[model samples]
Target: MRSFHVSKPRVITVDKNPAYPVAIQQLKQKKKIPEGIQIRQVKYLNNIVEQDHRFIKKRVRSMLGFKSFDTATSILSGVEAMHMIKKEQIDLRD
Candidate 1:
């Protein structure tokens, strides 16, 4: 959330985890996230997000672990870029 530098989300969808409610409550009390923001634990919504990143997870899982944070970051960024290109979400210009 801090890294994205985006506006506060009006809603946050997460899986049905016991800890999520506690953590979200703490964040709201600390003014980290808006108090009015809603949290949905619909399995379908979570499934969609997981499916979208399924490719990335499969690729990373085979690697076992990354040697360094910098290398991991670069590799993951490249993976995401390639995914976007394949999806035609990015246009290439020479």
Candidate 2:
């Protein structure tokens, strides 16, 4: 909201979720997003996010559910660590 008020972007692309338009309307009512700002709900606009989430989702589903916050955090941390390894963004030494 701060960015919207400060920069006052000309156009914003969001998911095709119907809730977004309503939320934007609320923002306009609150004078956050400018009245003339264009809000586009594009399909496949969030594909990159969805793709990234898929990897995490797969691991979580396979585990069914994590028993505790510490375990969940540690497990997800390792998952992301391996992902970074595969992407060559980080190196783990033996």
Which candidate leads in TM-score?
A: 1
The runs of at least 3 residues in candidate 1 whose Cα sits more than 4 Å from the true structure, single-residue gaps closed, are 1-8
Pairs of residues at least 3 apart in sequence or in different chains that clash in candidate 1: none
Per-residue lDDT of candidate 2, residues 1-94 (tens digit): 4565566579777778899899999999999767998888788876555567677899999999899999999999999888878888886776
lDDT score for candidate 2 against the true structure: 0.83
Query: Model-by-model lDDT, in order?
Result: 0.85, 0.83
Candidate 1's displacement at residue 79, Å, is: 0.5
lDDT of 1 by residue, 1-94 (tens): 5777767778888888878889999999999878999988766664666677888888889998689999899999999999999989898977
TM-score of each: 0.75, 0.54
Worst 10 residues of 2 by lDDT: 1-10
Off by over 4 Å in 2: 1-14, 17-40, 91-94
